[model samples]
Target chain A: MKAKKQAASIAANAGAWLITAISLVPFLLILLNSFKDSLGASEMNLKLPGLPLQLTNFLVVVEKGKLLTSFFNSCIYSVASVFLCTVFASMASYVFSRNRSKINRILYLYMVLGITMPVNYVALTKVMMLFHLNNSRLGIVLLYTAMQLPFSIFLIHGFVAKLPVELDEAAVIDGCSPMRLFVSVILPLLKPAIATVVVLTFLNTWNEFVSPLYFLSSSTKWPMTLSVYNFFGMYFKDWNLVCADIFLTSLPVILVYLLGQKYIVSGMTAGAVKG
Target chain B: MNKNKIYPMWFAVLALLIYSVLFVLPGLIGIGYSFTDWSSYSNQLHFVGLENFKTVFSADENYLKIIKNTLVFTLGTTIIKNILGLALAVLLTKSIRLLNFHRGVMFLPSVLSTLILGMIFTSILNPSSGLLNTFLREIGLGGLAKPWLTSPHYAFKSVMAVDIWRGTGYIMTILIAGILSISQDYYEACSIDGASSWQKFRFITLPLLLPTLATTTVLNVIYGLKVFDMIYALTNGGPGKATTEVLYTAVFKKFGTGQYAIGTALSSVMFVFMVVIGFFMIRMMTKDEVQE
Candidate 1:
C-alpha cells in the first residue's frame, strides 16, 4: 500500500512538471527566438541562439514594425482609461452605496448589467460617428472606459459599502463637503480596491485589440497587439523580428503581472466566490 | 443627516453618462435597428419588420451553424477547462516544491493578450517547420502533426484547444483559491475514518468546490460567446465556410461589408441572450455585497 501511494505521488509530480513545461515552453521559444538571427529562428526550434545574439532584432522591429508608436498608443490607452475607470468607478459606486435611492438602485443595476452585456460594435460605429469619437485616440480610451466601468463599479461598490457610515457622518458634521470628504477621508481608505481596479483596468486596456481594430483605423493609432500582429503578417518569414516585437509588446504586461499578481488574482476571482 | 445631501447623486453622472451613451445606448439602438433596413449601402431608413431575423434563423444560412459553433465552443471549453483546472488545482495545492512558481507559470497565459497567444499558436502550429510539428517529428510522432489551422475538420477544435490553453489556468487559479478555503477539519475527520485520498477528494473537495466551478463556468460562457480576438488572430474564422465563425466575427464581417442591418440583428441576438445571463451574473457576484 505504501509503495502504491508512493507511485501515485511520483505520478503527480510528473504531471505537474509536464503541465509546467507546456506553459513555459512557448514563452521560452519566444525568448530564445527573439535573440536569434533570422536564419537561426526560421525553424522555430528550442535550440540556443547563436553566439553574439542578434540583439539588433529588437531595433529593427522597433523601427520597421512602428513599435514605438504602438507602444505609446498602448500606454496612453491604458493609463488614460485606467484613470477614467478608477476615479469614475470609485465616485459612482460610493454614491450608489451611500444613497440607495430608487433611481440609484436601478442605475446601479443597469451599470452592473453591462458586466454580461455584449457591446454591439456595429451600431457602436454609428454612435461613435455621431459623437465624432471614431478613429481617434480619445475614442479608444472612452470605449475602454465604457467597457471596464461595470466591473470596476461592481468591485468598488462592494468595498464602499464596507466603509463605516460613521465616517461619513463625522466628515459631514465637520463641515466636509462631499468632494472633500471623498478625497480626504474615503479615497485613502479605498486604496486597496482602487489598486486592484487600476491594475486590472490597465491590463485589460493594454491588452485591448478589438476596439482599436474596429474604431482606430489609422495605422499610426494601432496599439501594440494590433501592430505586433501586423508585423507578424509582414515579417512572417523572419520569426526573429516577430519574436522581438511580441516579446517587447508583452513586457509591460509581464511586469505588471509580476508586480501586481495579488491584485490581479483578487480582481479575477472577485465575483467568483459566493463565500 | 440627509443621505442625499452628503452622498450626492451627481458623483455617478460621469460614469453613467459615459456608460449610457457609449455602452448601453449602442445596444439599445442596435436592437431597435434590427427592425429597420439600416445600412451604409443606402442613406434612407426603412422598417423591414423581422426580415433580418428571418435570415438569421433561416435554415439555409450559415448563421445557424455559426451559433452552434459558438455554443459548442463555450460548452466544450468551459467543461474541459473546469475539469483540468480542478485537477491541477488539487495537484498544486499538495505539498509540492516551488508551488507558487508552478501556479504562477500556469496562470501566465491568462494574463497575456489572447490575440497575442493566438499569433504565437499560429506560428507553433504552422504546417511546416513549426515548433509543435518539428518537436513531434523529433519524437517520432510526425504523423500526428496535422495542419492545425488550415483544415476544416480540425480548425474549430484547434481554436478551441488554444482557447482552453489560454483559459484553463484562470479557472485553475480560482479553483485553487476555492480549494484552499476548504477547511482542514473535514480531512482530519475523514482520515480518522481511514478514508482514502480519492475518497476525501470525491466527498469533500468536489462538493465544496462546486460554487467556484459554477463561477468559472459563468465567466467562461460570457467570454466564449463574445470571443473575437483569438479567432480573428488565429484563423479569422476560416479554413472553410463557417467552420470556426462565431457570432462576433460574423457580425464584424457584416459590419465590414456595409451589411449593417444583418450585423445589428446578429448582435441583438447575442445581446438579448447575454442580458438574461447578466441578471443572474450580477446577483451571484453581489450576493454578499449589499448585506442588507
Candidate 2:
C-alpha cells in the first residue's frame, strides 16, 4: 500500500510538471524569440537568446504595427466600456435585487438573455447607422457596455441580493434620500462586486476582437487585437517583429491578469458557482 | 414606499435604455432583416420571406458544412477542455508543490487575446520553418509534422488543438475551485471504507463535480459556437474552406460580400442556438443540483 501510494505521488508530480512545461513553453518561446533576429526566432529552439540581443524588435513593432495608436484605442475602449458597464450594471442590479415588482422580475429575466446570446452584428451596425454612430469609438464603447451589461448585472445582482436589507432600512430611517442612500451607503459596500465587474469588463473589452473587426473600418480606430492581427498579416516574414507585436498586444492584459488574478478567479468562479 | 419603488425604477432606466437600444433592438431587427432582401446594393428593402433561410438550408449546401463545423468545433473543444480541465484540477489539487505557479502558468494564455494566440500558433505551425515541425523532425517523427494550417484534413484539428490549448487552463481553474469546495471529510470516509482511489473519485468526486462541469461545459459551448477570431486569425476559414467555417465567420463573409439578409439569417440562427442551449444547460444543471 505504501509503495503504491508513493508511485501514485510520483506519477502525479510528473504529470503536473509536464502540464506546466506545456503551458510555459509557448510564452517562453514568445519571450526568447521576441529578442532574437528573424533567423534565430525561426529556428525556434529553446536556447537562451544569443549575444548582442536585438531590442529593436520592440521599436520595429511600434513603428510598423502602429502599436501605440492601437494601444491607445484599446485603453479608451476598455476603460470607457468598463466605466459605463459598471455604473449601468450596478444601478440595474441594485434595482433588480431591491425591488420585488413583477415587472422588475420579468425585466431581469429579459436582460439575462444577453449573457448567452451572441450579439447580432449586422442588425447592430444598422442601428449604429441610424444613430450615426458607426465606425466611431463611442459606437464601439456603447456596444461593449451594452453587451457586457447582462453578465455584470447578473453578477452584481447576486452580490447585492446578499447585502443586508437592514442597512437600507437604517439609511431610510435616517431621512436619507434614495440616491444618497445608494451613493453613500450601498455603493461603498459594493466595492468587491464592483472590482469584479471592472476586472471582467476590462478583460473582455481589452481582448475583444470580433466587434472591433466588424464595426470599425478605419485603420486608425483599430484596437490592439485588430492592429496586431493586421500587422501579423503584413509582417509575417519578419517573425521577430511579429513576436514583438504579439507580446506587446498581449502584455497589458497579461499584466492585468497577473496583478488581479485573485479577483478574476473569484469573480469568474463566483458567477459559475451561483449559476 | 412609493418613493422607494419609483427610485429603483429610475435606477433601471439607463440600463434598460442601452440594453433595449443596442442589444434587444438589434436582435429583433436582425430577425426582421432575415425575412427581407436587405443588401448593400439594394436601396429599398423588400420582404423576401424564407428566401435567405432556403439559401442557408438547401440552396447553399455548404452552409450545412459550416453548421456541421460549428457543431464539431463546439462539441470537440467543450468535451476536451472539460476532461482535461477536470483532470488538471484533480491532479493539481493534491497538495502539489508550486501548485499556484503551475496554475498561473496554465491560465496565462487564457487571458491573452485568441487572435494573438492564433498568430503565435500560425508561425509555430508553419510548414517550412516552424518550431513544431522542427521539434518533430529532430525527434525522428518528420511524417507527423504536416502543413497544419494549410491542409484541409489537418486544419480543423489544428484549430481545435489550439482552442483546447488556450481554453483548458480556464476550465481547469474553474474546476479547481469546484474541487476545493468538496469537503475532505468525504474522502476520509471513503478511505476508511477501504475504497480505492478510482472508487473514491467515481463515487464522490465525479458526482459532486457535475454542477461545476455543467457550468464549464455550457460556457465552453457558448464560446465555441461564437468562435471567430481564432479561426479567422489561423486560416480565415481556409485551405479550400477545409477547417470549420462557423456561423459567425459565415455571417462575416456574407456581410463582406454585401449579403446582409443572409448574414442576418445566420445571426438569427446563431441566436436561437445560444438561447436553446443556454436554457437547456441551465435547466439540466439545475436538475442536477436538485438531485444532489
Candidate 3:
C-alpha cells in the first residue's frame, strides 16, 4: 500500500510537470527567439540564444516598431481607464447596493446586462461621430471605461453588500458629507475589492486590441498590442525583431500578473464560487 | 438619514451615461440600422426590411457558415476548456511541489493579449520551420505534422486549439477557487464512510462543482461568441470561404468593406443572442446572492 501511494505521487508529479511544460514552452520559445539573431531565430526552435545575446534586436524593434510612442499610449490609456473605471464602477455599485429601490434595481440590472452585450462597433461609429469622439484619445479612454464598467460594478456591488449599513449610519451621524462618506469611509474599506478592480481594469485596458483596431486609425496613436501587430505585418520576415516586439509588448502584462496575482484570481473568481 | 443625500443618484450617472451612449445605445441603433440601407458609400439611409438578415440566414451566403462557426467555436471551446480546467484544478489542488508556480504559469496565457499569443502561434504552427512541426520532426513524428493555420481543414480547429490553450487556465483558476471553497468537512465525512477517491469526486465534488462549472460555461460562451482578437490575429477568418469566421470578425470585415448595414445586422443578431444568454447568466450568477 505504501509503495502504491509512492507510485501515485510520482505519477501525479510527472503529470503536473508535463502540463507545466506545455504551458511554458510557447513562452520560452518566444523568449529564446527574442534574443537570437535573425538567422538563428528564423526556424523558431527551443535552442538557447547565442552567447552574446542580440540585444540589438530590441533596439531595432523599438526604433522601427515605434515602441516608445505606443508604449506611452498604452500606459496613458490603461491608467486613465483604470482610474475612471474603478471610481465610476465603485460609486455606481455603492449607490446601487445601498439604495435598492424598484427603479434602481431595474437600472442596476440594465447596467449589469452590458456585461454580456456585444458592442456593435458599426453603429458605434455613428455614436462616436455624433459625439465627435471618433478617433480621439479621450474617446478611446471613455470607450474602455464604458466597456470595463459592467464587470467592475458587478464586483463592487457584491462587495458593497457585505459592508455594514451601520458604518454608513455612523458616518452620516458624524456630519460626514456624501462624498466624504464614500471617499473617506467606504472607499478605504473597499480597498481589497478596489485593488481587484484596479488590477483587472489595468490588465484589460493594457491588453485591449479590438477597440483600437476598430477605432484608432493613426499608427502614432496605437497601443502596444496594435503596434506590435502592425510591426509583425511590416516586419514579417524578421523573426528576431517580431519576437522581440511581442516580448516587449507582453512584459508589462506579465509583470502586473505576477505582482497582482492574488487580486486577479480573487477578482475573477468573485461570485463564481458562491454555490 | 436621507437616503438621497448619502448615496446620490449622480454617482451612477457617469457610468450609466457612458454605458448607454457608447455601449447600449449603439446596440439599439445597430438593430435599427440592420433593417436600413446604411452604408459608407451612401449618405442617405433607406429602410430595407429583413434584407441583410436574410442574407445572413440564407443558404446562398457564407454568413450562415460564419454563424455556424461562431456557435461551434463557442460550444467546442467552452466544453473542452471546462473539462481540462476541472482536471487541472483537481490535479494542482493536490500535494504537488511548486503548485502555485504551476498554476501561475498556466494562467499566464489568459492575462497576456490574445492577439499577441495568436501572432506567436502563427509562427509556432507554421508548417515547415515552425516550432511545433520542427519538434515533431525531431521526435521522429514528422509524418504526424500537417499545415496547421494555412490549410482550410486545420485552420479553424487550430484557432480553437490555441484559444483553449489560452482560456483553460482561467477556467482552472475559477474551478480551483470553487474546489477550495468546498468545505473539508464533506470530504472528511466521505472518507470516514470509506469512500474511494473516484467515488468521493463523483458524488461530492461533481455535484457541488456544477454551479462553478455553469459560471465558467457562461463566461466561456460570452467570450467564445465575442471572439475577435485571437481569430483576427491568428486566422483572420480565412484560408477559405468563412471557414473560421465568427460573428465579430465577420462584422468587422463587413464594416471594413464599407457595408455598414450587414455589419450592424450581424452585430444585432449577436446583441440579441447575448442578451438572452446574459439574462439567464445573471439569474444563475445572482441566484444564491439574492437568497442570502
The residue pairs that clash in candidate 1, if any, are: none
Index of the highest-DockQ prediction: 3
Backbone clash pairs for candidate 2 read: none
Please, what are the lDDT tens digits per residue for candidate 1 over residues A103-215? 98899999999999999999999999999999989989999999999999999998888888899889889999999999999999999999999999999999988888889
- Predictions ranked by DockQ, top down? 3, 1, 2
Candidate 3 lDDT by residue in tens digits, B1-292: 7787888999999999999999999999999999999998989999999998898899999988899999999999999999999999999999998999899989989899999999999999999999899889999999989999999999989999999999999999999999998999999999999999999899998999999999999999999999999999998999888888899999999999999999999999999999999999987876666421
Each candidate's fnat, in order?
0.79, 0.65, 0.88
DockQ of each: 0.79, 0.59, 0.82
Off by over 4 Å in 3: B290-292
What are the models' TM-scores? 0.98, 0.96, 0.99
User: For model 2, how does the per-residue alpha-carbon lDDT over A12-100 read when each residue is reduced to its tens digit?
Assistant: 88899999898888788888888999888766657788879879999989998999998999999999999999999998888887875
Per-residue CA lDDT of model 3 for A1-275, tens digit only, reads: 99999999888889989988999988998899999998999988899998799999999999999999999999999999999999999999999999888877888889889889999999999999899987788999999999999999989988888899999999899999999999989998999999999999999999999888889998889999999999999988889999999999999999999999999999999878984
Residue A269's C-alpha lDDT in candidate 2?
80
TM-score of the first chain in candidate 1 relative to the native first chain: 0.97
Give the TM-score ranking, best first: 3, 1, 2
TM-score of chain B of 3: 0.98
CAPRI-style grade of the A/B interface in model 1: medium
lDDT by residue for model 1 over B32-122, one digit each (tens)? Answer: 9999999988999999999999999999999999999999999999899999999999999997778899999999999999988998898
In candidate 1 chain A, what residue range of length 10 has the lowest lDDT sum?
A266-275
Tell me the lDDT of model 1 at B231. 96
